[model samples]
Target: MLTFVAAVSTGFPAQAQNDRATTTVDYTVRVNDTLYDLASYYLTDPGCWTVLKKLNRVADPKHLQPNSTLRIPLALLKQSLLAARAIAVSGSVERTLGQGPFLPLNFDAALTEGDHVRTGPNSFATIQLSDGSHVTLHANTTILIKHLRATVLNGIVDRQFELNQGEVETKVTPLKPQDRYNIISPSVIAGVRGTEFRVVYGDGAGAGNTAVEVLEGKVAAQGPNAPPVLVPQQFGVISDSAGNVGAPIQMLPAPSLAEPGQVQKGLQIVFEIAAMPEARAYRATIATDAGFLHIVNEIRAESPRALFDDMPSGSYFVRLSAIDRNGIEGLSQIYSFRRARPSEASAAATRTANFEFRWTEDAHAGAGAGAQQTYRFVLATNSQLHDPMLDQTALAGTRLVLSDLKPGKYFWSVAAAVSPNNGESHEKPASIRSFTVGQ
Candidate 1:
């Protein structure tokens, strides 16, 4: 049976109300329906069949199978030709698209002009524009996608975004001569072309300070009444809340990776950076995305490097920035990295009086020749390894031999340690093996 929600002149009734912030409505196919009919009713413009076809990738609008589903994109149905898409999201990120109420934003979600995006604490989102530019919103930030439009005939794209609060990182692609990308903060406007930059519009105590850091290419920052200031690579400017624009200052230099080419081992992915003068501390963020939509681990290290050990094995990116005494974070390049654990380990079968355990070695071990590995061996009678056990620590080498052991059934395992130091003590346990022994 086909279900229809009060067929009105605007086509079918919205089947499901998306509670979260989303721009598109889901519609189920019914009898005596054509793409043109659906578009005419819901979109109020039957001539938008081409846009609907492109949006839904429908080969034949006339042949929409019965009970088939379609997504009625409210953005395309609206007057705007371009929309911002959330390509990646993590944590509590939400958006308001078109007239739709705020809803939980997800990956690949599209937002129309005048849409708003807000991120909660520890939340992050990355949006991609039609021109291949990207904007990443950090935690506790709110931004409005004020305008996004493109003309197919002229191949011109014009975008405008407003950062209401907090920070955002932008990577703008090269645009056509007439194309434009503009970001407006509370006190200033930043215009860019084929550039990478970060903008911070403060809140609370930091209010009235709209800071712009140009990482690559250049950006033009201007106040409401002041002239534009050309900020080039590795430079920044701030517009105070009082409507006063400040002079450009040199941005903090990139901190060099201590061992950029080194493979990460053990549970902890350790990072070291060269010390920079006047650097009070270093902030490191690790993410799966190069743009760092959602950072998995973020830490502030007083030392030259940072260590992250709480994540699983996969390719990741590390971004390191310097923090001056005033808590201003400097610009840093994103570094690709991988966290790999030592190979799985196994123990010898059935042992009589003495038994030994061995495990694999990591190629990038230790300070030099090989990784410095310390092994911990455990021998227990039960698989649970509750009590009847001999726990040995600081066993140097791949194998450990235990003598004068009378056992019926014993379970043993080996663990590796990066060093003898007392920093973040977590046992990297290996696979356990059971053995039978006869006295």
Candidate 2:
């Protein structure tokens, strides 16, 4: 006996898919659906039913239950797998084609060979290659896509990027072992195979210097005159402005977070790293990204701990690296933490159009207790708070007022703070409260 059931949540796009490197579609099986029907509907070819059935390991196409999710492979869609696009872009980002002037880079911009991309101060961009690899550009960085092409028959991609300045983090896909991927700087070249690494160009005190930090796999860094240096996992190498490559150096071991344990309730991020025997001094950088491209604050500590104060409340990634006595910075260890101030929503009256919003105080708890905290509040008509009607920050008082808001539904949220300065700190907002003005 066969039964057809349509769950409430079973509705989905007939052909919808996430924009991953893989070219595929996520389709939900409808009542009395079969592999042939899906293949014909999506691929326009019922002959692909066997391919779809084999891909999903379904022996009996007649037994497919309703509301079951299936991944429809796109092998029949030629040229779909060969795509070069930007997955995400934040802040002011620009791109140029050939000798043309730079234009604002769109989030769905399709990248190709010879395309030049740059990020403004405090901005970042992420690019996806044909082979599902990713390259994240740091702020104030410029990169040229030297080569991006793949053979349809072999699925071998050749991707090369030239970093004119600043930093870039790369995550290369390991699917194709024979694929060629390289990051070229002014002074050196770093080549990789299915790994994660970071390259910084002209970052050192000296000009035209390049640094390669390998986080996962081995990276071969070469200078013009020096022999190629292989940087294995947790190791790094530096090239001087003169294109002289230095020997590989061990990265600093990751330190366990001591302060702020799991969470903190202040704008100040108290960073305490577990001691390391080889670490003389530590450098800490807090950013909104795991790649540390969007850096907010940086501090240096003679010991294993550093303090970042006066930052607004928010989520941030703290990156720490050990500096040997020789002044060489080792590999980095990244940790994510939240510096938030909690605020409670105040009661509202509908008699008058005036509304006063109040929230709880910032109670700095966990290792560093008794620290004075601050407050920031936001009032919006939407939950996402795109363009808030009332956005106030650095407010010492726990209350806010809107004199003449029209009669409608409104949402409000508040955040605690430790300082007036808005660093890269991400203060998670308290749960939002809704209120009505006039009927």
Best by lDDT: 1
Candidate 1 residues lying further than 4 Å off, grouped into runs, are: 1-79, 151-155, 203-205, 259-270, 289-295, 300-309, 325-328, 340-439
Cα error, candidate 1, residue 262 (Å): 6.4
Clashes of each: 8, 11
What stretches of model 2 exceed 4 Å from their correct place?
1-82, 175-177, 223-227, 262-264, 267-317, 323-334, 341-439
**Model 1: lDDT of residue 254:** 63
The alpha-carbon lDDT assigned to residue 31 of candidate 1 equals: 82
Model 2 weakest 10-residue run by lDDT: 1-10
Candidate 2 local lDDT, 51-98, one digit each (tens): 778877887887787888777654453222245677667778999966
lDDT for each residue of candidate 1 in 274-310, tens digit (9 for 90 to 100): 9998888887877664335446566678889787755
**Which residue pairs in candidate 1 collide?**
10-41, 20-103, 21-103, 208-241, 365-370, 365-371, 366-371, 366-372
Estimated TM-score for each candidate:
0.55, 0.52
Report the error of model 2 at residue 212, Å.
1.1
What is the TM-score of candidate 1? 0.55
